[model samples]
Target: MLRWLTRSLHRKLTFVLVIATMVPVILLGMVSYHTASTITEEKAKLTGVNTLRQVNAIIETMVLDVENMSVFLIGQQEVQSYLTRERSGASEYLRMIGFLTNLAFSKPYISDIRIIPFNGNAELTNTTILQSTLFQQVDTDPQFWKNNTKWWSPPLTTVTSSGIKQTVSLVRPIRDMNTFKTIGMLSIGIDTAVIAQRLRDAAVDGAVMLVQDAQGRTIAASSTSITPSFVKIVTDKMTNSHETERLNSVGEGEDNQVVITAPVPIVPWDAYLAIPHHTFSAQNRYVLQLTAIAVVLAVVIMACAVGYFVRQVTKPLIRLARHLPAVSLERAYRPLPVESEDEIGTLISSYNLLNENIRQLTEQVKQNEAAKIEADLQALQAQIQPHFLYNTLSSVQWMAWMSSNDQIANMVGALGDFLRFSLNRGMQMCTVQQELEHIRNYLYIQSIRYPDRFTVETYFPDELMGNQMLKLLLQPLVENSIIHGLLKTKADQRGLLTIEAETPEPGWIRLRVCDNGVGMTEMELHALRERLAHYRFDDKAALHAPVGQDTSGCSAQMKPLGGYGLYNVQKRLLLHYGERAQLHVDSKQGAGTVITLYLMSNWTESQLNAS
Candidate 1:
């Protein structure tokens, strides 16, 4: 489904445009929302913390007032003697009620007070009904009777004619003023409405207010709207740090809560205000809605633009395609009219330009074909004359033989064989044996010309002579030795040139041409080697096409740009065989020069036999 939606230029472009419009809007909204949310959260935390602290102070002050009142009542000489009395009359009991009533009514936070005596005397109370159930439950309640070191007791639940309610008490054992002995207990019930009202007043929106004892037990929570799981989480997070924390506490299900714990004075109870995380994000709702609206509007705008663009692009091509069936390609191109200066117009102009170039090329191809046919006929006529030269050479040899001149007959035969091998059907590579044979014929002619000027020797093994290599590779080296080395020797010196072939390794061959002629000096050898190194890079080192061939019954030599010497040999070896083929020229001034060519042997037995 996703691939199908993004398959076309229109849909993809729509997505791109919408995203381009929406990214900065969304980013700015997010950054603004985050900054505002942070500031608001801190403010909420401060307000919550301050409210909890004030509520804690109120509870602490109420506890202190109750404790001091209880002490003052117990320490009164008349009340102490009355509480310890073994027999108390109606006047004393009624008078004791007045003392307890005045102490209870002294503080506004004290709702109800009681004095239960161990001695056989009637209990004093402020209410006329004198609820006996409260007395019985307070006497029997397990949690209510727990030992406490603080001046005030932890919050305890009690049942009255009203519904269940929570309250703190200053429940202390009253001591006799004379002996410092404990009497019956005096419990001052703190006003439950006052504490509850305080909790409600401090309650921030979406905050679950709680009152906990010093033992970290939940005494009363102001909110029943909270889930039982969240209440459990708040109670479980007993942070020692006085500051509020985003306590990600308890067992994992919705455990995150912001718990602000403030220590209540005197009693050491803690007042906790737990605000849920959802409440903190209430401020970002407006920003998020605005961003979403902007994205939707951008998407709508993008849809209109992309649809219009795609229609404009595809309409022209559709119109052009409709005309294609009627269009025809003729010898001369007739241009289609350009309707508008858009890409479609350029496309029509390109089509007309291509058709014109194609028409011209068609005419050129026809002319080339005609010229090729005429040249083929001329080539056929020329083919008849090649054998004429061979026939003439054969006739000359026969004439020399008829006249009994064996030297002329032998020379003519050698010349004919040499010319035949040199133009061996235009094959660039020849066998080692055939190449050495060509060299032998050339040396015979040279020996006749300068009989005592030079001497030539050859060493070729039958095993290595059948290997195939580049044709005429050795001829240039031999020619260079004769022309530049051997022919330039001292008059007293008879130049001796040696030609040899060897196999240094399997599948590799080396051909050597050494001459005992006037060798080059150090500087001359350096200059020649530098020229050979840069032969391929030198523009003048390029081998030129021959202008014409000399067909006077002699072997034709092709003069390359750098002359057909060691430079030609180096260039040919590199061009044909790459770096593996090597040409090394070793020479000592006035002593000798050795030119060795190393190339791979690349022919099978059939190829050698064919050569």
Candidate 2:
């Protein structure tokens, strides 16, 4: 009877110990799996949110930079000076070009900077070295000027003059400051690879980065297979939900995975993160294994009267389960008071330390953000200096006129007109008539300074009088003749400058500028043709040399003009008219030089007959 009672007591104790050990292991496993899964999912969501925010901030900064650049250009006294003197000296025009080139170099992202006068000429007034290599593209593309909107385009393959290929362009139309007309477009090429690298850097582990167009075509991607179907899926997910959600999908070996989609929010684009189900499921696997081991141990330990040991292990786990809600809610989690110094106590202490580290990291992130803002402000200030110089030049021109030196007065007057036209007062387009008048003013002033050195005669058919041309078209060529061709001739040689516009056929107006002065050598002619063919501006050193070096004679009275003026004229014309208008230059040593411009006749049958 005594032996049976002891056996019954032992059996009861064994069952109770087994239940105590197994129950906590089962419960802790569920609780631990839930806690870890929740933390990981929350972290991924936070990462997606933070990434979207950063992309937004980057795009905003870029937009602000573009706007600031536009405003700086519009407010530039040099643009006004260039436009004001559009009818005057090549020197004034060159000055404007120099200013523009400097601005282009200051920004690495700015592929090119140009001032297209409303004249019917394609000339490059000012350009970066890289832009000088791509003049042909600007000169041949009429859509560049006709398009009125500001936007970025997909990667466009284009060959440089030297025959190198590049991609993607950002274009913004520059308007006439006074009339608000679209005069020319400013194009900047983005290094797509660099942008891709930036996106890659922003991506978190398991995250996919993508850039898409409005049509949902992926233009660029990082660490993701960017297919049309994938873009469509991402686009649909982003459109359907404002809050990001994790979707279940089959993974390798039939395992489950979670897909989290987020909108990039810079342009219309989407990003995704995938977390495999195994990551979450693994957390519970260890607990199940421990429960099996604990069951067997409980049976043996209970037989030895070790029920108190089972309770000691299970109690700590129960306390840990109670503390989970606090940790999840970001509240302080204090472990329950423990009398025993064991591994379980060490885990609680480590968790508290981790929470403290996260808090410190968050504070540091806030401080770094403040520093970025200050750096951006400094960049803005650096961009404003050139505009100030332009304004000062204007005041100086006015003072020169008041001094009663007509030569200086005329030069200053021409300078003012050229600046004004270059400035465009913000307009994008102007009539050919306006452009011609501007050029006439420029020539008149040059003729004043070198009355005996150059003569200009214009022959235009009455029918083509109303035709429109881009602004500042003729000024550069006229300036070029004076500075490069005519000025180079000996005084004994007659510097004859002739301009004629006639319609041999009903639909065409051919304008010509023929000069009887020093002609170009093969090398010089090749360089000239290459420059015009490529639409490149001359080097600043070349543009600023003594008049004789760029031209024909060493005279103290020779005007100081930059070579970029002619380049600007050619670029503006080609951008507006396409192949319908072109520049042609013919020169023979000691014989003379002639430049003929071909354009479409802006005349109706009635108008032609009436004239």
Candidate 3:
């Protein structure tokens, strides 16, 4: 049974059960203990306060009795007449003495009684001697009698003739009734042991009690179990006027103990109550036993619940895990069937939808790839056929002008070089140096065709000669400018064309082509920008026109040439270089047209060689 309990699901569920059950149990125990402790402390404090109040009431009554007797004695007609007469009748003096003696013996706490005459000459009378002998003091110093009139005087030690030690004295003044002059004084002594006995009888068990004067000196202590250290703590705390209850560690070594200290009400000292830690532990032992039994029962219940829960949760997760390996990248997988309308069922539904979408997307992607390949092939054929025919015609013309036709021979040579460079041997990219050579070849052909009508200027940094570019890009732009802006004009004046290259910043190159010819109107320019912006490349054939056809003399209402080659060039540049390879066109009507191409500078050697 022990082994089964240890190895069962209870072991795994112990943490949950312990946290759930023990947390509240421990919290409730702590709160109960704290609240009980607080109530116990408050009750102890109240008991101490009540005891102190009782003691204070007893002391106040005793003091008031002493005061009343003193007042009564001072008011006695015999004593007053005696003070005025400078000597009292012996019988009346004996009567006053008898009254005081009766007053002293009436209270058990009072130990002595006497009277002293305050003679202006400071002479010791027979009565003063009697009182001094009773008090066991050498003399009642006149200064002690003179300075104190109302405040209680400091305690004096008194030893009786029988050799018993006692604390002597509560004293007050006696004044002449008519003149209100200080004539003498009355005194009384209280037995400190009697006060201690009263406190001991009234105090609760485990209580420390003390009585003190205004200076915080101990007048009496009720329990001998209280150490000097405890007395010092009470005295120091009382002296500092600290009244709050506090837990104090007392004694040293094996005698160490904790106690709660609370101030006594209307008294000059405090009371302390102490209980050992073992006492609290002993009281809580049954609580601990109940907690252990509850924890054991809780563990049993939680184990069964957790076992059911974990089995239910882990089974689906394990099933999902088994299906994970069947999910292939090349082919989509069907999900496991939903067993119920729970978390696992929702997961299964999501998985199935994800797989279905992935499979459909995969089939659509394959179709799109096939169609793209076919379209690329068609585009390539379209590009290749025109160059093939153009090259063939140039070859035929070159053969036709071999020797006798010098001008035609030159034209054929320029055209052959232009065609060879435009085809670029079917290469897609070429170096800036090679592209410049290709442009030079095209310009040579254009110059041959219109010898005195145009002048071409080329400017390039030696540093940009090695940069790579898309093949035939610059040539087309240059051809477009010459054909559309320069060739259509009938002016005998020279058309100036400029080709320039520069690097304005790191990792960037700009190549510009400027021509002094008829520029487009704002409306035509706007139309051109709108077409190029859309990346439409279906109008290439419409842009191409015969070399000598003139549009300069045509009516202003005639539309300009339309084409997709320029649009295609801009789109391909943007695709490769993003926004950085922008094509900027600036033109002024009849002044000039400038086309600029911006591109990154870090083209590879192989790309440059191809270009």
Candidate 4:
């Protein structure tokens, strides 16, 4: 009876359709609601932490400004001279007081500026007059000035001419510049309300912010609504931990709140942002409830409609699946009957067309395999061309010697040597030694062609001789310097070319080709760079595009800005070495030009071959 029930496509589909429609509604809705709640809580906590850090940064800036001001005041000639003077005249005392008053007026949030002498004396300040004995207690305190240190005192109340003010002040000991003795003490008072108001402004509706000292005393708080219990938990966690930043939870379950803590920059203090976890979840609860209700209603409404349509659809597919295996290369398929003009019927027509095209596709695959083999053979032939060129040059050298034309024979011999080194076993890469030799031969032939044209100096370490680089890389650059840059200059001018190599950094090699020649203008260099930007090395069409002049013969006279050799070298350096490789051309008109190539020496030959 079970097999019979399942045998009918409609019966099987009705069971499947009911489970598919109801299971996701029941499972996914619950999972989505839980995931969303978790993410919302995390986002809220993250926002609190970021805001706390921002507030810390602002407070740190203000503290640093006060400290810097103290340093500046101690260096002032008037303050230093007045403090060191054993007995100050009335004119001198008035000058020092005037300077202090100007300083207090210029600074924001400053309640007073006072110079407290270490000796028993009296001095006027920005505020009321103070006797030296009043500050003598602070001067004698070892904790306040240990190792000639500067520090911030905790918030305290002081009576000033303005009113009874609560402030935190930065204290610095004034010392004699020549004797280096503790002369006096300087205090700059900053209003605590300024910091309190900043913290309050940083905290919005969802969070409470606090700025507290190292002793866990609250320096400033955003609101009085913050519970003492929450403050104690944060203080305990901060006092026991050395972390610069951290996030923690307070209380349990629904009563829990997330507390984020960060250090105030350059101050021995911490900044805290405490927010209830439910603050983020409260906004998401109604959404989750609505979603759950909608999911339940959707499942109930779709049950009957899904069962009926799935039964209609599965019967045709059931027939189609049973005959698919029989449709193969060695046999024929029983054609699916088109019983209706719906999507199922259209599917059957498409299947028939696919079956008919299988034979043609097999033949096309065979032809593609043949074409790939032919392309590989052509690539081998191309690799062989370099060897063929080497042999031909050697033959021409001996022929010129047989004719006894000394200059012609020397040129051909040099050209042969250049090609032999360039071939370098058809690997397209060679050691630095072989590369330098190749350039020497090319320059030799050029020297014969243009006598006393340019003097070449090569400086490379003996240790880097074995390092490998692209074959014939430097020859083209040198040729460019001689032909384009040096040739344009006056004959009387010294045409100098210097090829040097060194390790710029670990695992990196740099080569420089510098010439004291008529260098390119800014426009020329910009145009050359634009050409390089558009040239795609991997695209065969772009590489073979009409780059000016063949770089094969070293004597080729390429336009300074339009040389294909420089572009070819640039493209190959980027393609083979990846983006870490760099090529730069620096030139100034009438100054000189320097071409720099940066390459990683850690790469191996097999890696280049693979690329």
Candidate 5:
């Protein structure tokens, strides 16, 4: 086979192409089969767990009703007197039996009620005329009491006038309400048929609902498939197992099933909802079969397409080998058709990429010139203010030293530091700590300028100092908050401004400036956020962006975002960081405003130049 393919390039290439297509399709089918099986089983397990929880809740509600009734009976005056009285005669217990009868008739699920006296008196079922015994089978765990009532018993068989019935009994030690002493014990029998009704709703497709007591005895079940033998198999496999609320498979002869088990809330019993694995996977099987058919069809279609494509690809090579194709810069640079993923195809792709790079580099050159013009204008305007501030602060520092005033001296030193950081015209960006220190110096000056009018809070992480962002963004936002937000508050109210730096997610830094002062109305906020969303890397707008006046040219009614406002910061962000930068503003009238910036971490000078 290798020699026949090597005799000609066409056969070898066709063989290679066919093998590549066939191998991936076969491998993908295998992976899809395994993945689909795993996903189907997981979905089945989740469904089973939810169904069991619903069934357990219903059973808990029934048990709670029984416990509530026992609480009322334990506190009854007549029943408390019968258990604690000095009189031991038969007539004294006669009226106590009447109270038990009235309690049993109230709830329809209650089959019978028993009051077992601890002093060895006959247990009263209905009246003193008949007696019963139940405690000899159960030693009450006092630690499990619901106030005066003890925890319920497992299901038990009882014969009444109607027939033999399964009943789950609730036992309570009657207490004297005043002394809180155990007077006597009472037992309430609940029919298990009501439990079967609750289980019916939990039945999944081809599912059986079987409940077992704490001792792994099947007490209540509601399916025809459940026999004594099957119940034992499920209980044996599931009872000692430590799995909680998850479906596990049980193999029993010809029957294979998956079950989800949940403990009944009030009683120490487990409820099992077993569904056949076959029934759960029936739809999954249909999908797998359909996938097999699709894979076969895909393989057939791939062969036909590859046959015609390779022929066309070979003809192009045969024609090109005779003489090179003519090339000229005047011809439009549209992409040549991709015939096949081969050696020739890679050559074509590289050629296309080179053309794309050339086109992009030319466009980038134009954008760079526009940005340089903008930067020079900004630097010219920026140089004037910082030198003026620095010179004034130097004079104040000398005056404060002569007067021996430490507060005025500290304010002058902060102003000097702020000016020193702000006057870096050679660098367009700075580390996060540099920007934070700049803001702190500015805020300190503002605090000294308006001492009792407002307060400032700042949070900057030390670890984030290594990350870099555009300089002047944070200070401008902080100044806007102080002027438009904080200082505009009512006379009686104090103002607060919070500035924070944190990482909202990995590889992303978030800068937030918040104020608790007069905020923007809805209309103003909407117009501002809409304005920010429309800004892209607009070369013309950024180049001609007026430094001394607001030339944003969008709306006269809206605030001009030329020099320094919330929207101006966003335009700067888009100019340098491209789509990796985002600015969002939220405000409500009379409440406050919050400005948030999301930027990629560790931004570099190359990114600004490219943008």
Candidate 6:
């Protein structure tokens, strides 16, 4: 499942869509639930405080009514006559008890009433005998009866003539109306059940309400199963606090409950509300459940929608992927069908065009290969004719020598040597010495053909002898100078041919072929340089291009080169050595023409072969 989730685009898209939709929804749900929970808790605390306050009011009113009854009985004529007489018959005592009972009945929360005389004697009562232990403490402690202020007794469980009751009483000292002398005590027993019932009526759901006395004893509790720890927590909070009402918490986990307490003004008691924390979060719980449902629904819908859309996109890509192998193998591939007029459709069209271009490029490459072979064969055929001519000339030279014709033999010998070096077994490169030797042979034949008409001078260093250069480089240039320049001069004005070679700087060799003969004008020099600029050795046809017909006006036996010799030298130099090889012509009418060839000096044999 993990691998599929990682590898499948469809699965990944679905997962992302689900996450994208659900994350913010879940986050918002949590925030909203927390916010609602906080508000609900605050409202619950306020409600509990208000309810406790109301409980305080009800219990205070009930206690005040009981205390008011004591004041009313103290002023009663029947009770004053009886106390003054200091002795009462059974009828009078019974009558006083009946009046007290009737008064107790008048106040619903009062269970019993009693009148105690200080003379170690009990007077009429509501059928409950006051225990001597309770009075002994009051008698021994004069402070208990010293004041006329009302007081509340501590919580206790005792048997009354009516029933076993858990209660506390409001106690007041009855004094003489004129003398202000203490006579007896007036006591009214208030049942804790009345206060507990009032607390219960004011409580919220899951809330435990209690009425506890000033001494931290529980008068009554709304919940029968109240924990001791919870009671202690409330007691400690009420003990340490000065506020009338506030919110608090007790215990941990399930035992944890929120407590709110308020003082009861009519008595030394406190009204407490302790609600379990989870109970107050009922509304927030409903919100969280609803929010969870909403998030699930949203994620489900988004996942379905995103999955369908992603399938639409990835299906086309998958089909396109199936064609990749054919492109890799360089095989003919069918074009993808255009499904829409979108970027994908445009992509398919571009791919089809690229495939077409590849086909044309392949055909062009094949044609180029075939043309290369044809040029090689033509070059071989070209070499064969020169070979045959050299053999025929050598035979002619032998015959001339046998016939004792020295001039004919010498001229034919030079011709044979020239042709042998020119062919050079179809090699485009030859040593500088070999090339100079070939040029010397050509000059020898030319000197014989036009003796005394031109004089040849040669100067070169031994260092340059070992340098390799393109074959036939110097021959054509010297030939052009003799036939076109030296021969143009008259016999009385004899021409001079100078061939010089030198190293101008490190890594560079320079050669010059100069003729002190009829030179060309500036216009002709410009036209010739322009013609050389257009020259290319690879295209043999460019050599045959007319560079002005030769006008040397020498003997008709002089061969017609069509003025290609000088241009051929320029083309070969530029082609073999690139631009680094410089060819320049210095000339002026009635002066002389100097042709310079600049080449690198340190090129190796392998480098020359590669060139």
What does candidate 5's lDDT look like per residue over 467-502, in tens digits?
988888998888888888888887667898899989
lDDT of 3 by residue, 1-611 (tens): 56755553434454455567557655665676666555555555555556666766666676676666667777888666655666555676667667665666677777666566755322222122322343334235656656755334334555555345445356666788888777876666667777678778776664556665656556666776766676665445332444665655565554444455555443334444444334443444565556556656666676667666656656776677666667665855666788889877888788788778777888888899999999999998998785687777677676767656766766676676766776666766678898898888778777877888888889999988887776677876888789877876776877888999999898888889898889888987776676555442243322233322332233323323543246556755654455557787888788878999888776764644443
How large is the C-alpha RMSD of every model relative to the true structure? 22.8, 46.0, 23.4, 21.7, 21.2, 30.9
Give TM per candidate: 0.43, 0.36, 0.37, 0.42, 0.39, 0.49
Give the Cα error of residue 371 in candidate 5, in Å.
99
Candidate 6 per-residue lDDT, tens place, 1-611, comes to: 89979876767877887677778877877887787788888878877788888878888898778877888888777776666666677888888888887877777778778787765444768767635234433443457566437777777765766777777877777777777777777778888888777777777888889987767778888877877777886656444343467677777778788888888885677778888888768735676677678867876777778878888878766665566546632465467787878877787778777767777787788799999999999999887787588778889988999999999999888878877886687677777789888988888888887878988889989988987677777877888788778888887888889999998997788889999888999998886776666654445454344444332222334333654466556655665676678888889998989999888865665776566
Model 3 accuracy (lDDT, Cα): 0.64
Ordered by TM-score, highest first, the candidates read 6, 1, 4, 5, 3, 2
lDDT of 1 at 222: 74
Q: Count the backbone clashes (under 3 Å) in each candidate.
A: 0, 74, 5, 0, 0, 0
When 2 and 6 are scored with lDDT, the better candidate is 6
The candidate that achieves the highest TM-score relative to the unseen native structure = 6
Which regions in candidate 2 have their CA more than 4 angstroms from the true location?
A: 1-20, 74-77, 80-101, 112-118, 121-149, 155-169, 224-230, 240-611
Summarize candidate 2's per-residue lDDT along 1-611 as a digit string, tens digits. 55654554444554666676567656665676576567656665566557756754554465456556766775576664454343646676666667776776676554445555554333443342333333344434457556534555665444444333334455566666787665555555544454566668886664556655555555456654556655454455344443453443434464334555555443444445444445543434565456556655655665455566544556666566556555642444344565457987877676667667766776677689889998998998787554564676677777877886666766766766666776676554455566666777778777776777767677765656677544455666777777777889887665777777777676666767777777878787776676555532333333334423532222333333564454445554554455456788888887777887776555333432332
* Global lDDT of each candidate: 0.71, 0.58, 0.64, 0.76, 0.76, 0.75
Residue 482 CA displacement from its true place in model 4, Å: 99
Which residue pairs in model 3 clash with each other? 118-184, 429-610, 429-611, 430-611, 431-611
As for candidate 4, its clashing pairs are none
Candidate 6 matches the true fold with a TM-score of 0.49
Q: How far in Å is the alpha carbon of 24 misplaced in model 3?
A: 4.1
Q: Which has the better lDDT: candidate 3, or candidate 6?
A: 6
Q: For model 1, how does the per-residue alpha-carbon lDDT over 1-611 read when each residue is reduced to its tens digit?
A: 68976665556665676677667756765676677678767777777778877787777777777777777777777767777988889998888888767766777666667777778777776645323344444444334345542245556665544445556666666767767566677777775656766788778887778776766655556765656566667767666544443333234435456777776766656677877666776745675566567656766676677668766766666556555554443445566777889888998778768767777887788899999999999998698665787899999999999999988888898999888887788677789999999999888888777778888889998998777888878888888888778888776779899999889999899899999888888887876676566544334324232322222221233233334566667766665665678898889877889999998897543553343
Error of 6 at 377 (Å): 81
